[model samples]
Target: MTPQEWVTSGDDQAGDIPSPVGFRILIKPYRLPKFSAGGIALVGESKQYADIAKVAGQVLKMGSECYRGERFSAPWCKIGDYVIFPKHAGQTIEVKRNDGQDPDQYLLVNDDEIRAVVKDPSQIKAYL
Candidate 1:
């Protein structure tokens, strides 16, 4: 919910993070590789992320793409992060850290609504 919606609801504080559901997520480690800098690695096996065509864009998921329609956006999800989507109503999905054997999909990490994973403080602060 947006800030205004959250406040009008009055059920809880806006600062209290809601659950994450139906969100295209980005999975990543709380602490990323300062060494790797820019590279794609599998989810879990490494902290590296998959740098894709729209990796650094502001909008995590634009809802439509020229080639890949409704593609899952946001590759920076992590444990305890809240996610939301139309598919999942009334409940949100919280991103949890998983161990992936492959490094290539590290950038693929996971899917959620948020721009980046809650694991990345940088990404979280931006939303705040």
Candidate 2:
């Protein structure tokens, strides 16, 4: 099924995130690394540094108008794709889950903000 269809589907729905309406993208940022390359645990300031270091994320959804502009062409990224965007390019949104646990954080970014696409985010050394 297409990303849009899957999201709007009714089967066992946990809840829906804010659907990107225009040239927008919904992404779930990869969690920061818990330990450094040396295997030492990162604390307070270190953890904060790790968090801000990430510019990669998983594409959760996209707006219908994404890449469809009068001057632009087509979109390069799709749902489920790993994309690299500018640091601090998107807005943070808290999503309330149906399981009643803590809300998850998501980024709402414009399609134009995406800089590059990676097949596997895990392959990124910084993230690993």
Candidate with the greatest lDDT versus the true structure: 2
Q: Indicate the residue-level lDDT of 116 in model 1.
A: 34
Segments of candidate 2 deviating more than 4 angstroms: 1-15, 33-40, 123-128
Candidate 2: the clashing residue pairs are none
Candidate 1 residues 6-74, lDDT tens each? 223322322322222243333221233324435544465333322221122111222222123356343
What lDDT score belongs to each candidate, Candidate 1 first? 0.28, 0.74
> Candidate 2 residues 1-128, lDDT tens each?
23333233332434567888888899877655556658888889878766677777789889898988675766779998888888779899987767776666779999889988986554443442
Considering every candidate listed, which one attains the maximal TM-score? 2
